[model samples]
Target chain A: MPYTAEISRTNPGCFIFLVDQSASMSDPIGSGEMVQQRAQVVSDAINRLLTELSVKCAKEEGVRDYFHVAVIGYGHTQVGSAFTGGLAGRDLVPLSEIANNPARLESRTKKVPDGAGGLVETTVQFPVWMDPVTNGGTPMTRALGYADSLVARWVDEHPGGFPPIVLNLTDGESTDGDPTSAAIGLASHATADGAVLLFNLHVSGASGTPVTFPDGEGDLPDTYSRLLFHMSSVLPSHMRSYAASQGHRVSDATRGFVYNADITSIIEFLDIGTRATELR
Target chain B: MGAHSTHLDVQWFLVPKTGSSSEECEDAIDVLLSPETSSLFAAVSDGASESLLAGAWARQLVHGAVALMSAADEESVVGQDGLSRFVVEDLLARTVDQWDGYLAKYEAERIARGRPITWYEQPGLDKGAFATLMAVHMREAPADPENPKAVRRWIWRAFALGDSCLFHLRDGRLLTSFPITDGHGFGITPQLLGSRNRNASLIADRVSTATGELRTEDELLLATDALAAWLLSHPEVDSGGAGRQLGRLADLDQELFAEWVQNERDKSRMRNDDVALVRMRVKTEG
Candidate 1:
């Protein structure tokens, strides 16, 4: 019931994305045709997630501000808003503003089923809000702390609403220090609905079968993933149900953690909050 | 011998679900009165809120259903053994075909206007427009020459593909409720009619049908899921009290109905959703 709170424009939920922009993120992940810089992959995931959220809440009038969002980038001994263009340096912006003020829209070609067995290539408008940035060391602890402050304030302000969700996208390396305590502290903040949800997307170069929404850390490839898993909030029952519905092997104990795979699926785990009570 | 006949009193109301403005109401209802045949047809469709252009799809479906019923031949109208599987299936398949054409035109228009479909909208569109459909038809049986002064009887048939319900009341008591009977029956995933589903047999397999008799003063209520669910949840419905409440609304205008729905939603007695209802009463001449 915690995650079941109605998410309306009047009682919006919050999203805090912590993106690791450290130098090591510049390294290529996954060899061969799938190879891409860790930073690029994370940036694409963030952008796609934002687009998905915007589209989910979109109506004829435009996107509803059912959520407020923040994108924080940490690297080179600095942590700040990664939003570019018109929204540069802004934090916790309403979803309507985010939808209307995309840095730019890119026309991307996609192949879709043509209803006659084959695929048809078509152009689609894709909006971008942030670009890949790689700098110095991975100060992940500070990044979690930054999200912590935001979560603390958001819960205080929206005490009766669904708790904020913090998604940390990072490579396994942490140059600053272990982020366990910081992650725990970040997840400890609460609203009347529930405690903050700290989910992790480990964008690693290490090659292993990608594990997503695992209940235990036994299958994790490295200690870094295990640490992040330990710091993650268990998937609320509703999120677990959604993950199961999406064909992911989920259990009651499954945490909101995705390792070495596309984290775009995480967007589906968040309840759009408000039920369709009115249909206009 | 004096002639006896029955006429229909029809009224309909629609309100968008809570949290949505009135302009966003996606549920659609349509009634087709055929004075020449002394028959009345009504339909309601609830568009899946998750799908793109759902409101347009729902509106098209209900209109298509009514049109199909209006044009049915004698055999199709009476149906095979009281259930018109073929007619129902053909209606659904044709609606899907019509939706295909609509989607193409919609896409072309968007492209022509320099606002092509966004990546976000494409996936939902490909899944096709989703909606639940229910339709009812009522026709007066020919009067018997021997008993010309007897009360006229009307034959009524209902077809349902999802959670939408049709409730029949006689003498102010609940007579029958079709498709869904309890509030627990409503789920997040109701059976939906997909715009791209071309298999008539598949559509026919999911369709449910019921037939009954309506005499003078009998009332029939057709409702989309939200209002139907609320009606089913009340214990009074079994005792006919709920039917009386619905029958009383036959003369109320849309604004009053909207207020009643809002009040129910405020009390948390009904789920906030686009609410639709069509009330039909059988009238008799003394």
Candidate 2:
């Protein structure tokens, strides 16, 4: 019942995204035959997160401000707001504003099944809120601390609402120090509903296979992946139930951590209302 | 199957989620009285809040179900001996086509108002709307000749999908709970009817039907998911009666109903979702 707070305009939820902008992120990561820059992967995830949230609460008037969001990036010696365009320098912007003030909208192509044996190419308008930036050291400790500030203030403003969820997109490397304690500090912030939730998405360079929401770190292959996994919050009951129903083999110990896999699936963890069983 | 029967009292109560406005409420209900057939037909649908135009789809679904059932030349559209699977599936297949017409007009009106659809909303619209439906049809059974004075019965049939429930009550006790019997069954993303779905067999497999007999002393309650869950889990009902709260359900007007719903939500007795309730009691007086 802890995360079962009614998220609405009167009592909204909050999201704080922590992006690792270390120089190593510019390096390409190859999984099978496909290659993608870690920075580009994280950037795409953030933009999709915004889109998923906006579409969830959208109505006839427009996207409802059922949530407040803040994106913070850490690189070199700085940790600050990652928003671009009109929303630059701003922290904790409402969802409606985020929906209206994206940096730009880019047309992207994707392949879809055409009800035949083959796939067809289709174009979709993709909104961008941040560009890939690979600057200096991965100050992940500082990044967690930065999210702590936003989460602390948000819980103060909406004490009775659902707790803030901090999603950290990183390569599981820390330049400042081990980020375990800093992650704990960030998750300590609490509202009447529950404590802050810190979910980690590790974009590893060395990957045999992409792991999603693993309950244990046994198959993680490296220490950095294990460290980030240890710092993540367990999946809430509602999200866990959804995962189990989807045949994901989830349990009470399942954390909101994804290793090398697309973390955008976590956006579906949000409990807005009854959604379609299948997208089609 | 008909001997000029009618529902004596028909009342419906609705309230949006605690923080939402009236327009934001997505649950829909419609009751049609067909004098020609001496039948009472009703339908209630709970729209998935995450889908665009869900409320409109729910409205269209309920309205379509009742209209189609009543207009059918078949003696009984859906009953114990009725082909409920065919009737319900065909109704869904047709409603989706009607939704296309609704969308066309809606789009034109938006353009006329100087505001057009946005990119983000298009995915949800294209995916089509989804909602849970509970539809009922009732008629007086022609005086069971062998048991002529068998409490002057009425036969009712209901088609259901998702967590919405139809409760049959007599002597202030529940006799039946359809589709979902417990509170834990809610919030499970029950199989929803999509706006573009035309697969008859797919619809038939997901739909459920129940038939019951109503006496002069019997009453019925049709409720959407949230309220239905609360009723199933309510300790008051477990204490041997639904008398205090449910007995007076038909007596409540919109204002009183709203107050009761708000109180339940404040006490954390019910989930904070849009609620719709329809009450039907037999007319005892000749």
Candidate 3:
């Protein structure tokens, strides 16, 4: 027989979350919630996402064989050990460990209706991966660069594997330098046979239209949206399904933010990223 | 009122071009070794290279089917009859079920990993993971207390669902050759494939020609796609070659078998197809 190779068993894919924790993130939106408060909502969403993932992985042999998750945050130039305050420097960590830590700063709690006339209460954790320090300028460029390197390293280890996904949540423009170059650099990484996909969640306080891909002159800065769009990889099959099922609901195209007063938008963003990254 | 005991050698090869391997074969064999039937039934599944995961699908078919067969009552003639059909029907159903379950879990895992879930889209049924199956049930009949050659044997049957086959040669005379399935021609385009058309039932053939007398010179060759291509390349081979070359190649050198396959593949007679062959020689009369 000619050389026959073992095909890889079908695997789901991996997802990494990159959150922004700059001091400017503390700025309050137009009579709504501040960036600091929104961080808790996103964290709650991450916790919910983890719960859903664990349930799904337990039932699937291939899913367990193929999937992994990590979270990274950027702010005050510190990385790693979200709850412990020990800086590991621009790295991602699993969710369960973060949930167990007591030293992590707590974001505000909110109780929103579950659509059944019942209120569901939740606590938001600050900086799941990297925390923000108020001392310096916004390093959106460096953050993008770090995220790019992270995804590249992930794909190199998983050849013939599903591509990795990066979901970067940001509030402001790059103050340290131009972010366009870093965005392009991030777009260049891919597996031997596949590619990495990145999504940008631009959180703004102004009333505007939500530009997911960003062209010229919409709600948020079109240039930033375009840059992020350029850095993003094509939507995979799974990611498309997820987006179709939940993206619209979470990230209202009409609203310029990923979430509203409640903190549910973070879950929606995750839904979009999760579903979009599943493309084969 | 009752019967017991079972023994048989089962073998298979993965279609090379299709990217199936002997490792998968070994996995199928492990499943086949279960204590499910008194007359062990062996199978080989060849994946269609034109489809993705066909090889893995083929291996899954054999292993899953064998696991199903082990639970069948080997001594009950009527029960075996129903089981023969159930093995195919139930096995296919189980495989599909397993696949769906895997997909669901895979999707969830993606979410947990903070990734999305994507399902592969094939134009038609044959485009997704699909494989051909060939299987046989063999049992050694009770021996005449003092004479081993007098031992009666029963070949419950050799069954197929889709293209794989089982063949037997009695003193160089071709007795049987099962043919591959010609599933819906929708495979011609990328837009035609769907889950409904992946596998098709080819033919069900049981050979009982050599039951009465046993000869050590008899030979049986069970094969999937690739090996079939080689046998077809010989001077006088065709769709009927499985039944034609049975006993004729018994005494032929094993090297010739390998060479025939190689030459045919090189000549494109086999088209670099995945080939899996199982050659068996009756060592003793019983």
Deviation of model 2 at A262, angstroms: 8.0
Worst 10 residues of 2 chain A by lDDT: A271-280
lDDT of 1 by residue, B105-186 (tens): 9889988988777655666777777899989988887788999766667888888889999988886677888889788999
Q: What is the lDDT of every predicted structure here? A: 0.80, 0.79, 0.48
Off by over 4 Å in 1: A105-126, A173-178, A209-211, A217-226, A259-280, B1-5, B73-78, B81-127, B171-173, B249-251, B284-286
TM-scores vs. true structure, each candidate: 0.86, 0.89, 0.46
Off by over 4 Å in 3: A1-16, A23-36, A47-70, A77-137, A148-164, A189-191, A194-196, A204-227, A236-265, A268-280, B1-9, B12-38, B42-286
State the local distance difference test value for candidate 2: 0.79
Interface RMSD of each: 3.4, 4.2, 12.2
Candidate 3, residues A1-280, lDDT tens digits: the string is 1101112224335677766777766655443444344454455566556544543332112222234566666677653223234434425444233333323445758787889999998864333333333334567776777777767777676665556677777676667687777766775676654556666676655455444432223443466555555555545444444455653422222211232222345556676666522111
Clashing residue pairs, backbone N/CA/C < 3 A, model 2: none
Query: Residue A44 of candidate 3: its Cα lDDT?
Result: 52
Give the lDDT of residue A232 in candidate 3.
52
The DockQ of predicted model 2 stands at 0.42
Q: TM-score of A-chain in each prediction?
A: 0.91, 0.88, 0.66
Clashes counted in candidate 3 amount to 30
Query: What TM-score does structure 2 among the candidates reach?
Result: 0.89
